[model samples]
Target: MMKRITKLVMVIFLLTGISTVNGQDKYGTEPKKCQQNLSLFHESVKAKNFEGAYENWKWCFDNCPKASLYVYSDGIKIAENRYKTGDKTAAAKLINDIYTQRIKHFPKNLGKVYSDWAKSLIKIGATKDQVFEKLDTAFKADPTGMSIKNLANFFQEVTDRNKDTNVQKVFDTYDDVVEGVNNKIDKLTKQSDVINAKDSLGKTLTSKEVKKRKNIGINLTALGQVEGVLDRIISKVATCDRLIPLYQKNFEAHKTDSKWLRRAVSRLFSKECTEDALYPKMVEAWVTSDPSPKAYIFYAGILEKRGEKKKALEFRKKAIDLETDPYKKADYLYRIARTMYGSSAVSYARKALKHRPNMGKAYLLIARMYAKSANSCGTDEISKRMVYVAAVNKARRAKAVDPSITSKANGHIRSYSAQFPSKKILFVAGVKSGSRHKVGCWIGETVTVP
Candidate 1:
């Protein structure tokens, strides 16, 4: 008798379109209808019939909010189409809704979703605070997932908000963004290197590989732009005058903190603040606390500044040996080269090339070294001008290897080419324009007379 009564009540509830809370599934009550709508919407969206998809999509969205992630993803496409067709207000609202619901149902890729949301907000002329709110969340969740442009914009927002009262926060944000960008660039560079090597061996790439190479190039270009923006934004506040006092004030508190010491040392070194009284003290503390490769490099710089060349080179070698990453090792070699002169500097730059063949800065450094030595390199005007030929050759190589430095390398090429031997001078010296000539002295590079 009890079983019969329960069955009757359940039948009545079903007939009356009522379901207990515990009995509800992700597809909601009347799941067959909800699933039908989901299928109908999906098919319509696939056919690019957004108008046909809309009603059914809305039904699924309202009735079965957690049915599937595709509901929101496909909805975004519909909304974007609408946005492009002049349904500005409604489309933006729907897109925001999709982002919110997608995040609620599927929390994966939270950072990317928030960044996309922020970008959408920007397009609709949203206030800075509104845009920043989304960006801040995105940056905190997963900075690596954010686009290069978004990362740079986030840093700018951070700087504007904290520059006056909390300048350290601004600096920290800059470091974080730069580190993220460098990490991404490093990964892409390794992949690009592999593709480049295969191409050099005359192996044909697949369609997918070719597309990937193109994308990597585009991304590298964007990342390079972001880096330039970051430097420009930080340069104003990162001067030695500003950095000296800032570090001086924080040194007492951060002396024993290795991470803090490293950043301080790096910033000071980059700003060329090594002559200050506080620099040595900070370096000593940093080395004592953590004698890492970078610490040793800074220590070497100080030693060289104090006129202890032999000791400096010893520490630089120590730094090089301690570093395990070939890229970092190359960077340290370049830094050491920057402090040297003439042939020695060129030698160290070449060593850097052995580790990272795509390093354009090393080539640029060599070109500058050769140009500076032109006067001392030759006794005659024609011979002196031949050094510029070698310099131009190096600048051209720099431009070819690294797209990021194209403009800078072109400038160098132009400057060097201007100093090429005049037509009459070449004739008087019996040097044909296309004839090979060896530049003597420190730079012994052979180049065609131009």
Candidate 2:
């Protein structure tokens, strides 16, 4: 530094035209152009311009060495985009390079980009070990993320991808594809995580979390190893005893996030260990507190899943009444039809079709309702078989409107093709007549696990 100062002084004294890059920091602070390039990179991604993203990202990475961490996320996103959109080799190269060069920056964004990128990898069918490895790396890099445990827990189920019979039946409908490199991570496949998943919420652990734990117990019911999952959920809820009042007070806070709460409800329903005395109240809490269409629908769906047809129908109707989304309202109506499956269900399904004329699921429901008549599950003759043809026609129309549900819609059509119903039709309404009697009847007459 002294030598440079002396040189500068001598240059000025000698009146020489010695020059230097003014305003440039010797420590390599990024230039404004780098920021501009990064912005452009984001814009290109938003615009789906893959070519532009690579170019802009390249410029940003070259100019902003210190901010290379930021580029890693973008690079990963572009790589996924490339893979999903059909540039397999290029996508693989991009993922490999970004992962290699930015290993230290793995947890830089933590949740926003990092989690999403991991989800994308899962969508591509990443193996469980691979996803866990990445998440483990992320935790090692920045274990401070509020969702660290939550993400870990979420990925625990990746292996159960096959368990979603519904997703498997309608897999082709949703455009879920992540090509190129394999995603070995599978969620829902791992053992339950014991790590504390501190909620990312700014508020204290919410009544919502309590409710969430409450529901987790429910969702664990009937699944294999039900006792263990139920115990875990009960433990979580018990930990929040002091937070019960807060959970009660902040019930309204959940209007903004009812889906999460409903998920907890579903989880709770899955658990078989819930106190019998607490069951009705817990179900009521979900139904009344989560008044949103989705919450109501999910709650009703949970009841329907447990073969509580009357309650399911009621909740389904409530969802239909609360929902403002035309599509969603139709969806609820179809759910109602799925539960009731008579003229009443048919009426709602038609109403749903009327509201969202293009919805294929509604048409599928119409067919299912038609097939309900032929359902041998009923002690009396099933609803009626002739109506199924009309239902199939409606389902076909729905498929015409939205091609995605074509497979399921087609399934509905084929379901009628076979006159026999493969599944049971629990006299759901009969169960509501009285609890003890219904329990006895269900125990005596209902189907059991095969």
Candidate 2, residues 1-450: lDDT per residue as tens digits? Answer: 999999999879666432222223311355567767777888787787866688878766555644545577667777777788876766766675666566443435554344454555565676766665665554334322314333334323331342233322111111111100001011111111111134323436667656654443332221222223323433333223322333345445663454434543444444442334333444556667666776676666557657887887776667777788765676677766665645667677778777765555666665565555544423442223323434556667765544445556666767664542223432433322112211121112221211
TM-score of each: 0.80, 0.38
Best by lDDT: 1
Provide the global lDDT of candidate 1 against the true structure.
0.85
Model 2 stretches with alpha carbons more than 4 Å out: 1-130, 133-261, 267-278, 287-322, 374-391, 403-407, 418-450
lDDT of 2: 0.50
Candidate 1 lDDT, tens digit per residue, 241-287? 88888989999999999888888888888778888999989998999
